[model samples]
Target chain A: MTEEIIIAGFGGQGVLSLGKILAYSGIMQDQEVSWMPSYGPEMRGGTANVTVILSDDRINSPVLNEFDTAIILNQQSMDKFESMVKPGGLLIYDPNGISHHPERKDIKIATIEGAKEASELNNKKTFNMVIMGAFLKIHPIVLMENVHKGLEKSLPQRHHHMIPLNEKAIKVGMKKVKVIHDYKKLVAEE
Target chain B: MEEVKLMKGNEAMAEAAIRAGVDAYFGYPITPQSEVIEYLMHEEPFKRTGMVVLQAESELAAINMVYGAAACGKKAMTSSSSPGISLKLEGISYMAGAELPCLIANVMRGGPGLGTIQPGQSDYFQAVKGGGHGDYNLIVLAPSTVQEMADFVDLGFDLAFKYRNPVMILSDGAIGQMMEKVILPEQKERLSNEEIIKHYGNWATTGKPESRESNIITSLDLKPELQEIHNQHLQNKFKTAEKNEVRYEQIQCEDADYILVAYGTSARISQKVVQLGREKGLKIGLLRPITLWPFPKKIISELADHAKGFLSVEMSAGQMVEDVLLAVEGKVPVAHFGRMGGMIASPSEVLDAVEKEINKI
Candidate 1:
């Protein structure tokens, strides 16, 4: 199986790290993976995006224009990536600070109030973890056990203390995600 | 110990150099490739394997440092981006002329002069044709995957010493910055002074023993006749390398009507184009030139005997296309398609170009 994903948000929103976690998890699963970041001076503060591909076989073209999934964290990313999702693909975004929501009828649209959830957890840094949990809830591409193992592998030893907290934030995201549109059902209704 | 790890291409190259027992690495950081030096610094190869890692005063100093270490028969390397590579050209020429062995990696960015910091393949001509002055050719390796980015470090060093010529790893920002899983090589022991003297004693400038005269390392020859002889020697070495080191990969080319010629990151992208084109009933193939200098001209010429046409896909405005034209020798139409100034073309866009080329045929 192959999953091509794009994770996009503000530079400081942990977008790149979120993709890294997925890539690391893929490695733990003995899968071929590639993470290509849109790197430049803009990575300091501007809109940053990364294309992560995980495949059962060798991966080709790390940089792709279309994605099976788009994890968007900001409105700018939402505006730019909403049209890039493949037909019947999934798009997950944080409702916080988002003035525009995904309106495509040909794909799945889900929301996780990552900002509010992280605020409730009293750690805004866990926002990406929360969003990751929501993505796993919608599509369990990599198992939770692999994720924990991947977190241990990716995060430094000092950050190991926060793994449980991050795990809890992911569970919170899994429980909190609301699917606003299901493309299959929409197509059925049509 | 050998282990699997996910690493960026630059970091993989640096880590591979350490594992390959590189004696020293001197470099000045540049965007898209700074991680090579940064990874080397963080790993502290000196602590791990007695390797020296230094941030030189400038690109010139870094290359000259490589020249010095290589003259002593020590495995040495340096890396930089486009503009910084331009600064090191004179030193690179001197190294080539002196018959010094070293590795130089240009993680290229778009450029005429300090162009965008994003990935680009505009340095194709600079790498394969000869960026440095004088009549010389650096063995150029174009890595498409992070694994190759790691593997080529060892291969580049081997080829450098085998030919006593400077070898270049010509990659773009895309390959340098992207991350993928790599099997870190087994750590090899660095060569000792005694080992250097034993292995390269005849040519190396190791402390001379009473048995031999002092070895001089210089590219200069005041007499034009002697200089011509030296140039001839270099040319013969290059010709030998061309016979032995031309590396490339051909995918689905047995019955393909159209073949896409590309290398490095462009090869990776064109692979997808081949898939998409095949899905649409187009007989597309890909020829990725791993050794860009001793280019796979023979294979292209052979493919030209069967294929309907060829398209050279690069991130530059048609650089490698000239090589394709030379190889095809007008046997079939050859076209160039690319996006310049750090803009990467999409698979669909590239397919469109392929179709246009096929239509023209």
Candidate 2:
């Protein structure tokens, strides 16, 4: 199986770091992975995004036009990537600062109040971890233990002290996610 | 011990140079490739391996410094993007003329000038067809994966020394910025000055003793007759390399009706196209040229006899396609598909292009 994901947000929202963690987790699980970031001036306070691929087989293209999942954090990203999701795929977003919500009926859609959860925890840096937690709750592609190992490997030794706090933030996200649309449920209703 | 890590292609190149026993690194910072020097500076290779890593005042100065260090039989390298590479062409030409051995990595961006900071493969002719001047060729290696970005550092240096010519790692920003798992080779000890004399004293400007005549390293000969001979010597050396160092990979080509030829970033993208086409029963294959200078012409010529058509995919405006056409010699229909100005073509688009050519056939 292969999971192609795009995580997009402002540069300081930990978008790239979240993708790096997921890539590291894939490595820990002995799966092939690739991480390609949209770099350049856009990285300086502008909208930044990274394309991440995790697969049971060798990955062919790191730069893809479509994705199985899109984890969007801001309205700009939502506007850009909501239409890029493959049919029967998933899209998860943070519902803060988003003026127009996703309106797709063909895929799964969910929202996690990442900013609110981070503010409640009194740590804005854990925003990405919360979002990651929400993603894992929806689709547990990787084991929790591997995610912990990935966090350890991604962060430097000095940052190890904050792993517990990040873990707490992720747990909060998993509990707080709201599923707005499910294609399978819609099909059953029809 | 072998170590595995997820690293960007540029960072892997720097770490590989350090692990390959490189004696010095002289380079100026440039976008899409500055990570090579930044990683080197952060790692402090001087402290770990006694290697010198210097940020030269300019691209010109950096390449000249490489010339100075490499003349003494030391392993030296430099890296830059398109514009910065243009600035180093004079030094590169001189190095080729003098028959010096050193590694130059060009992480290319879009350009005829300062076009864009995005990745592009437009420098194909500049690298493989003698970028600077005269009839000199650089052994150009195109790496499609992060692992090759590391492995080719050692291989480039080896080819440079073996042929007494300059070697180039021709990559683009896409591969340079992307991250993937790489199994890094073990650290190798730098050669001592005494060892240098023992290994390359025949030509290198190591200290001269009473044992033999002084070694002179120069591309200058005022006499026209001897200069022609020197040109012939360089040509013969290039011919030998073309015979012995051609490297390429063919995937699913045994019974393919169409073939896609590409290198570096374009090759990775076309590999996806190959899979996409095969799923639809199109019988497509891909040939990736690992060495751009000693291009896999012989194999391509052979493939042209059987394959109904060929599609050359690139990030340029049909540069390598010229060589593809020359190799195929009109044996089959040849088409070119690409996206310029840093825009990459998608797998579906490339598949459509090859399918169009096959339909015509």
Candidate 3:
């Protein structure tokens, strides 16, 4: 199973970090992983992005022409990557940022106020964790336990207490996203 | 087993480097090729395989690190785009002059200045003809597919060591950024550090110079005759490489009336043009050069006998096409098709150029 996901947002949104976590989790779950970042000259205050592909099988290419799933953290990100999503794929958008919901009917669109919900936990960065949890609940490609361990390793020691908070954020997101059944249609679901 | 998986050429090159048993990676982050470093950074090949990986201060530092590691005969590589490569030319010329083997991958982007981050193949002259000011040629391997991205590492390093010169895996942004399927080779056989040191450690400035005379590695030759001799020797090695390492993919060329010369990312697009030209009953064929330095000039020269006209297609304006004319040597008129400044020459555009050329005569 190999899944390609793109996480994008404005600067300082931790979009790159979220992509790194998925890459880390893929490695932890005994899969070949490749995480690619898009930072061409624009260092800060610019759009940031990361492409993460996880496969139980060998990974062939790290460049993705079309992503199987796209998780957008802001309106600009959604607008940027919405065109590159594979048909009938999963797109998780933060409702707080995206004013216009995507018009695609073939793909499953879950526009959630996940960021607003995550900010309730006193950290807006946990919005990615919230999206990650929704990703796990709906897709469940990697084991929740493995992802938890990956988060533990990736998260700073100071935020060790936020582990529970992240977990809860995932649960909140899991409930809101549309549960996808066709495993073949998604990624890494052989 | 042959398999297909969608991948970008840059990522595939990184994966291929790992498979090629690259011992160390010292490079600065750059566009169109950053995916290679990003892959190694997160995958942390060093943690898994104990390979040395460092993001250096500058491209200058990165190439020097390669020079140092290659002196020890260890498998080391550095990747960069256009402008960054200009800085490394001095080091590359030095690596050749000093007789060190290393791998350098350049996913070429637009040139001159900070042109654009998008992909362009304007570095052909810089790569094949030698961008550095010296009389030396790096074995340049240009891959047309993602598989070649992985496959060229083994080939690039092999040629580099065989000739004792730095070799380049020349690819562009289209190949770097585009996704394609590739089958990875098993990397069980790798050169150990001790083995590397044992092979080339004698010259490596390793706590020595007191026991024996100092071993100075430099390209400077005060005597004109000595410099000419050195140039001749370098030319001889290049001739051997040219004889031994010429690689080209020929398709629909069995009875080809017209030949198309292309390489790397441009080759993939040229393939479709060959088919489209064939469909139009043009008796057209394509020759995709896999090795840019050890060019398949001999083959292209031979193809000139039966061919009416040769069309050289490239992403750059007309760098590689000059080589085609050199190879053909007016035996057949060599035309060109290209889209520079980050423009990709599509299949239809190539076919249109061929058709227009055919109508000229």
Candidate 4:
């Protein structure tokens, strides 16, 4: 099985790092993975994104136009990537700066109040971890044990003290995510 | 066994150079490839492996340093992007003429001049066809994965030393920036001056011993006849490389009706095209040229006999297509599909080009 994901947000929003963690988690499970980021001037205080692909078999291309899942953290990213999701795919977004909500009827849509939740948790840096928790709640591509190990590998040793807090933020995200539309249920009704 | 780690292509190459017993690294920083030198500086291979890593003031100075080190029969390397590589053309030509063995990497970006700092394969002509003046050829290796970016360092150095010719690792920004799992090689010690004398003492200018004739390394020949002979000798070396060093990968080619030919990142996209076409019951295959200089003409010529048509996909305006045409020799229709100025062609786009070629055939 292969899963292609695009995580996009503002430059400092941990968009690239989120994707890197997912890729590392995939590796923890002994899966083949690739992480490619949109680099250069565009990544300096501008919209930054990364494409991560995890597969049981050899991965052919790291660059893709369509994705199975799109984790959008900002309004600009949501607007740009909302339609790029494949039919019956999943799109998870943060409702913080979204002026226009996603209106697609062919894909599954989920929302996480990541900014509000991070503020409530009193740690704005855990915003990305919260979104990742919501994603894993909907689709458990990698096991939680693997995700914990991945965090250990990705973060510096000094940051290890915050692992429990990050874990708490993820659980908060998993509990707070709201499903706006379910494409599978819609198709079943049809 | 060495451990596996997820590494960027440029960083992997730097680590590989340190482990490959490279004597010195002289390079200037450029976008999309700065990580190579940055990793080297951070690792401080001089402290770890006794290898010298220096940041040159310019690409010209870096390549000249390579030339100087190589003249002493040492393993030296330098890397740059398109514009910086352009600045090193004169030194590269001199290295070829002087029969110096060194490694150069061009993490290509879009260009005629000062192109965008994004991934591109537009340097195909400049790399495979010799960018500098006069008669010369560089053994060009095209790597599509981060692992290859590391493996090719050792391979490049070995081939350079075998033929006493400069070799180039031709990669693009996409591969340079992407991260993937790589199994790094074990560290090897750098060759000492005494070892260099023992192995390459015949021609190396290692402080010419009193017992032998003085060794000289120069690209100049005052007599036109001697220069002609030198040029012919270089030509013969290129021919030997062409015969023995062509490398390529063929995927799903047997019983296929159409074939896609590409290298580097374009090859990655073409692989998806092949898979998508096969899903639609189209018999499509992909041929990736690992060595751009040798061109893999024999394989392409053989495949042309049975294949309905060929699509040459690249990031340039159809430079490699000329070579493909030469290989096919009008046996089947060959078309070109490309994106220029750092733009990437998607899988669907490549499939559309393949469908068009098949229809024409």
Candidate 5:
């Protein structure tokens, strides 16, 4: 399956890091993956969005038109990417901030108060991990073990200590999903 | 034979420099060209084999460092894109005036100013014709593949020392960022510096205490006859460069009626276009110039005999076409297709351009 994910937020909101984790996860799943970001001045401030495309075959184009999934960590990110999300695709947003639901009926909007949950867990910074947890719970793109391996490859050597906390945040965020994509059932028809 | 792995243009260039047994590298980071520094930095080439590496404050500083190393008769190089290269032209001119041997890699980008970070081959004239002010030429090598990108690093240093001229690796974004398979040479084939000094040390400014009377490195000679004679000497060296440095790749030129002249990234895109043209039974082929200065002029001028029309494809606003006109010498009518300020010409667009020429031809 072809999956396109655009993770966007303010520069320090860990948007780039999250996109890297997703890309590494794709690589772990034996998928052809590419990650491109806004560079130069656009990267200094404002919104920093990275487009990641993972496919079973070769990726001809790295640019994304409509994302299959979008993980918006802030209000500005939600405003920037909500309309760009594909119909029936998932929108994982910070529950404490984003308010407007996309008027689209086909797509599922999972606003799981991620920042608040992370904050309640005494760690607001792990909001990215919360979003990733929601992603793991929502999509069967890869198993939790694969995501862990992806994180291991993507994280900096200095940030190895953050791994278990990220895992904990992912599990806590996964708890709120209350939904899982049944890939096995869907595979029967395809 | 060496085993080739898929590698990007920038990675290949750095790899080539390392494999070429480069003794010193002084460079500043710039878009498309930054990865060369990045690869060398992480690979810690200096620590691995006791090579010299310096990340300078500016492109000016970097080129001067290359000059210092090259003056010592050591294989040295610096890499930067267009704007950074413009900053180094002053040093390049000095190096040429002193006749110090060094290598420079220009992974060119779009610019008359700080244009864009995309690929462009507009620096053709600047590199080949000598961007620096002087009656001299730096042997410019244009590579279109990962293999050539690496191979030329060694070749550039060899040619630079052999002719006592600066050698350039004329590469662009396509080769800088794109990944291709390349077979690497056996490390045993590389030369040690003691062997290099054996070749170039005679003219190097090592020291005055033990050797000759004095070692002077300067571009100044106010005397008319003296400077005139120096200019004539440089001209002769350039003539030697012209004779020895012509390198190019020809694809299906024997039977093709139409020719596509491009290099670096534009050349890779042209390869795909040539394949499509051949599939449609259009007699189209590519002539990729591997060396821009010694410019495969003889090869291209000869191909003009069989070619019905020549289309010069570039990433700049039709800069290299002047060189094509020079080479073809009006044997066949020449047309140009290009995009400036970091825009890349797609393969389909190239095919469309070739079709437009075919319609008129």
Candidate 6:
């Protein structure tokens, strides 16, 4: 199985790191993964994006045109990546800065109030982890145990003490996510 | 000890250099490749392995520093991007002329001059065709994955010392910046000054030893005939490399009607094209040149005899296609598809190009 995902947001929003964590989690599960970030000038306070591919087999290309999932964090990303999601795919977004909500019908849409939730937790750094948790809740690509392992692997040794707070934020995100549309249920209804 | 870590291609290359027992790394910071030096600085290989990592004033200085260290029989390396590499051409030429064993990495970006800081294979001709002014060839190894980025540090250094020639790791920004799981090489002790004097004492400038005559490292010759002879000697070394060091990987080429020739990042994209084309019952294969310089002429010529057509995919305005056409010798239809100036050609676009070439056959 292969899952092509694009995670996009502002530069300091932890977009690339979120994708990196997901890729690392895939590695924890003995899966093949790639993390391709948008580098150069675009990453300096501009919109940042990364294409992450996790596969049971070898991943051919790190860059992809379309994706099975898109975790959008801002309005610019939401506007740009809304149509790039494949039909019957999943689109997860933090509805904080999104001016125009996704209007697609063929795919599933889920929202997590990541900014508000992170602020509520008094740790803005955990915003991306919240969104990651929401995405994992929708599609359990990796086991929760592996996510903890991935965090330990990815975070610096000095930041190990913060993993517990990040874990709590992730669990909060799992409960806070609201599924706007379920493609499977829509198909069944039809 | 085998250790698996998720690392950027640039960082992996630096880590590998330390583990490979590299003596020194002199480099200037450049986009998409600065991480190599940054990693080296943070790791402080000087403390761990007694390896020297210096930040040079410019690419020119960095390459010249490499030349000086290499002349002393030290395993020295330098890395840069396209524009920075342009500044290093003169030093590289001097190293080639003097037959200095050193490693250089070009994490290429779009370029004619400061073109773009994004990933591009535009340096294909510049790298494989000798960017410097001389009748010489640098052993060019193209790495598609981060693992190879790490692995080629050792391999490139081995080949450089084997032939007493400079080697280049010709990578693109995509591979340099992307992250992947790499099995890092085991740490090896850096060669001490006594070891350098022992192994390379004959030709190296390791002070005048009473045991032998003083060794001089210079590219100058007062007589034109003597310079011609030196050129011939360098050419012979290149010929030896062509025969012994050519490296490539063929994917599903055994039973295929169409072949796609690509390297580095383009090869990664072409692998997807191969899979997608096979799903549609279109027998397409990928021929990836791991070593771009020894050109893999024999293998491509052999594939041309069986394949119906060839498509050269690249991130430049069709550079490597020239070599492919030369190998094929007009035996079959060969087409070129590329995206220049930092834009990457997607897998579907590569498949479309393949279909367009296949339809002609």
Model 5 chain B, poorest ten-residue lDDT window?
A: B185-194
lDDT per residue for candidate 4 within B1-361, as digits (tens), equals 6677788999999999999999999999999999999999999999998999999999999999999999999999999999999999999999999999999999999887998999988999999899998899999999999999999999999899888899999999999999998889988788887887675646777786789998889999989999999999999999999999999999999988899999999999999998999999999999999999988999999999999888999999999999999999999999999999999898988898888878876
True lDDT of residue A161, candidate 1? 98
What's model 2's TM-score?
A: 0.99
List, for all models, the DockQ compared with the true complex: 0.86, 0.80, 0.08, 0.84, 0.08, 0.86
- CAPRI-wise, candidate 2 is medium
3 or 5: which has the higher TM-score?
5
Per residue, candidate 3 scores C-alpha lDDT tens digits across B1-361 of 5543445678788877877788889999888889899988877888767778899999999999998888766788999999989999999999988878899999888775888886788999999888887888989999876668888888888888788889998988766765544577776345765565475455654445466776566668899999888889888998888888888888888898888888876776677677768888988888988888888888999999998999988877799999999999899788988887776665677789999987774
Model 6 iRMS (Å) reads: 0.7
lDDT of 5 by residue, B185-283 (tens): 555233455565576666676555664566677789999899999889988988887886677888778898999998877786787788779999998
Model 3: lDDT of residue A114: 69
True contacts kept of each: 0.77, 0.60, 0.06, 0.71, 0.00, 0.81
Instruction: Please give the lDDT score at residue B98 for candidate 1.
Output: 95
Query: Model 6 clash pairs?
Result: none
Model 5, span A1-190: residue lDDT tens: 8887888777776777777777777767777665656544556777788777677874533444568888776677787788888767877766565576445445666666676778878887787888778887887686788789888877878988988999999888888863323334345557
Candidate 2 ranges beyond 4 A from true positions = none
True lDDT of residue A129, candidate 6: 91
Candidate 4: where are CA atoms >4 Å away?
Answer: B197-201
**Model 2, A32: alpha-carbon shift in Å?**
1.1
Residue range with the least summed lDDT across 10 consecutive positions in model 3 chain A: A179-188
Question: What does the lDDT read for residue A117 in candidate 6?
Answer: 97
Which lDDT tens digits does candidate 1 get at residues B1-361? 5598989999999999999999999999999899999999998989999999999999999999999999999999999999999999999999999999999999999988999999999998998888889999999999999999999999999899888899999999999999999998888889987886676556888778898888899999999999999999999999999999999999888889999999888898899999999999999999999999998889999999999999999999889999999999999999999998998888889999999889988
